[model samples]
Target: MKQRSSPSAMTDFYSAAALVTGGGTGIGRATSLALVREGVRSITISYATSAAEAERTAKELDSLGATVLVVRADVRSTGDITAMFDLAANKFGRLDILINNAGTTRYVDLKDLDGLTDEIWDLTLDTNLRGLFKCCRAAALMLKKSGGAIVNVASIAGLRGVGSSIAYSVSKAGVIQLTRVLAVALAPEVRVNCVVPGMVLTNWIERGGGGISTEEEAFRVAAATPLERVALAEDVADVILGLVRSKLVTGEEIVIDGGKGLTY
Candidate 1:
């Protein structure tokens, strides 16, 4: 794969700052790196429990000559989320970008109603949906001050009904809707958009055992895709980079599944 050194379009991010939630790994990590490569001067990345991963990401970004702040935060806690925004604002002096990428889910059969316990539902909705809303709300002031942009990492599961779990699917669906609502509300000041990724080859899936339990299943899914492949974290991040750089684009949801979603 040809790596993108920076966003295709030029952006003033070289002098700006950003905050990326769940930036420890997966698409979040890729987005964080993309932002740094695109010349974002300072970034605050939040990780729930991935301290090792967060440290690794920080080191990588630091090596690239970007100011990085790694915070331990749980999206479910309003206080932690608020602190994340405050730290970014205080350290960076201004916040120009917010990436709502923190999310959680467990792999469960859709037919197993008993397996979809209240705890699982709460965990998924609180982190994936409600927590994202809180982050966006907390970021409003800083973003408005700099006329910044917000890019949410939703999933193709949100558009369809297939995902790791029913609650996860519902939560992501809420994220898609939330993106549109925030876009209209923050208009003329801050832009809000989302990227819906489909079946990305990330450790997140393996951790949750998201039905692709074997390499064979993954290969089958890839073969079924029109593009003969699934999405990569960097692929989704590139689309996000475009959204962040485009001053004229807002309230849009970009699908980055390499045409796999079309089959669904």
Candidate 2:
């Protein structure tokens, strides 16, 4: 990849190493590529079940001249999260950035409280909220040593209180609040921020997993949006890259919804 001019003098990507969870696909993949384009040479990407996709992404990063390490890690398990961080530390000796993008959700209407079973709530909370927290904790010492930055992936669902399921929305809301608290806790050593994306045209929605599963439904959402379009994963990734490079910004959430949230 062609390297771009460094955005901030405070952070040097050429000498830094980063860890991106869920780096196999979607926003995570985009963010990993953005880091490579910014001259970051070393990266460790963690995935849950997308082993094949993670390998593909690693190959692409290698082609871009980045030193890539792909690891299988399910964020829902503390042991997995710990092992992933340990391996990164051993391989890179330091960590300069962390992107907490691994998450899971189920499709159930918000009003159907009964459908939002205990299993759904547990899975969503454990994977999205709890898992993210564990990853942050695991990377804390290294990030503090490097004065690194963390950009978390939240959702417009947290802000608007509407999403695939009540549990999913609630879990994301926790992530937003957790970002703010961690910013204070990490202090001058590390910066924490979040990105809230609206309807992005990714496989998550295209495959009928997230709501608006079909192209026709997605088009309707885009037409209703103020910008008359949905977001691409790269769009959100750009904001994530900006946040990581920024020195003064912390505990902030940038929304990449094409202005759809304003109407609601």
Best by lDDT: 2
Clashing pairs in 2: none
Candidate 1: lDDT of 123?
93
Which 10 residues in a row give candidate 1 its minimum summed lDDT? 2-11
lDDT of 1 by residue, 1-264 (tens): 984332322248897888899998999999999999989879899999899999999999999999999999999999998888888888878888999998888888889989999999999999999999999999888788788899999998998879888999999999999999999998778889999998888876667754456466568888988888877889999999999988888889998877877776
lDDT of candidate 2 over 77-195, digit per residue (tens): 99999999999999988899999999988888789988999999999999999999999999998898888899999999998868889898999899999999999998778899999
User: Which residue pairs clash in candidate 1?
Assistant: none
Error (Å) of candidate 1 at residue 100 is 0.6
Native-referenced Cα lDDT, model 1: 0.87
Candidate topping TM-score = 2
TM-score per candidate: 0.93, 0.94
Candidate 2 residue spans exceeding 4 A from truth: 1-10, 209-213
